[model samples]
Target: MDHYSFDQLPHAVSELHQKLDSIQDLLLESRQPVPQTIELMTISQAAEFLNLSVQTLYGKVCHREIPVSKKGKRLYFYKSELEEWIKSGKKKTMSELREQLPSLVVGRKGRRH
Candidate 1:
């Protein structure tokens, strides 16, 4: 390794500290699961999560409006699938209109006028 003289030491020290901070952040992130990676919920938990009554939740399951896993008499719901089902019902807000643009707004090369 190249040795840093006293003049270069202070600046090198700051750079080393920044590198160590970034490594620490990476280690912490590796220990945690992502927001979307959640546990499966029971019928009661799923109903509470979706802010619906148990009867309403059962109605949804019967109507096949939501995603669920059935094992014998038990029902299981993944938060991710439930979230996706909710997202499927969402209509685009006015502010999100640009997201459905036919052309690239920031056209590259000869595409832009």
Candidate 2:
């Protein structure tokens, strides 16, 4: 280890203090609670959240086309699951498909040349 001269002690202390402050900020940030909360909604609320009419939502539920939970006679929807359901219906663009083609070709075996 290098020895610090007397005049350098204050500068070294200030540098150490700044490092400690940065570490403390990181520690405090990691200790904070996550903000994800499970939100359950009724059929009507789910319809409004998805911007669909109640009748359309019912049709989707009857056809088992959307994520849902049935408890007794009432139906429930989780906002997170609904969000995922919407994402699952997304269509890939041509550029996305092209980007994936190389990986797709690499995974295949026994190709005829």
Question: Among these predicted structures, which one has the highest lDDT?
Answer: 2
Candidate 2 clashing pairs? none
Candidate 1 local Cα displacement, residue 3, angstroms: 12
Candidate 2 lDDT, 1-113, residue by residue in tens:
76899999999999989999999999999999999889999999999999999999999999999999999999999999999999999999999999999989887855766
Q: Which stretches of candidate 1 lie over 4 Å from their true place?
A: 1-38, 98-113
Model 1 score (lDDT): 0.90
What are the models' TM-scores? 0.57, 0.68
- 64 Cα displacement, candidate 2 (Å): 0.8
The lDDT values for all models are: 0.90, 0.96
Over 1-113, each residue of candidate 1 has an lDDT whose tens digit, in order, gives: 98999999999999999999999999999999767656799999999999999999999999998899999999999998998999899988866777755345555545736
Task: Name the regions of candidate 2 deviating beyond 4 angstroms.
Answer: 1-27, 30-35, 104-113
Give the number of colliding residue pairs in candidate 2. Answer: 0
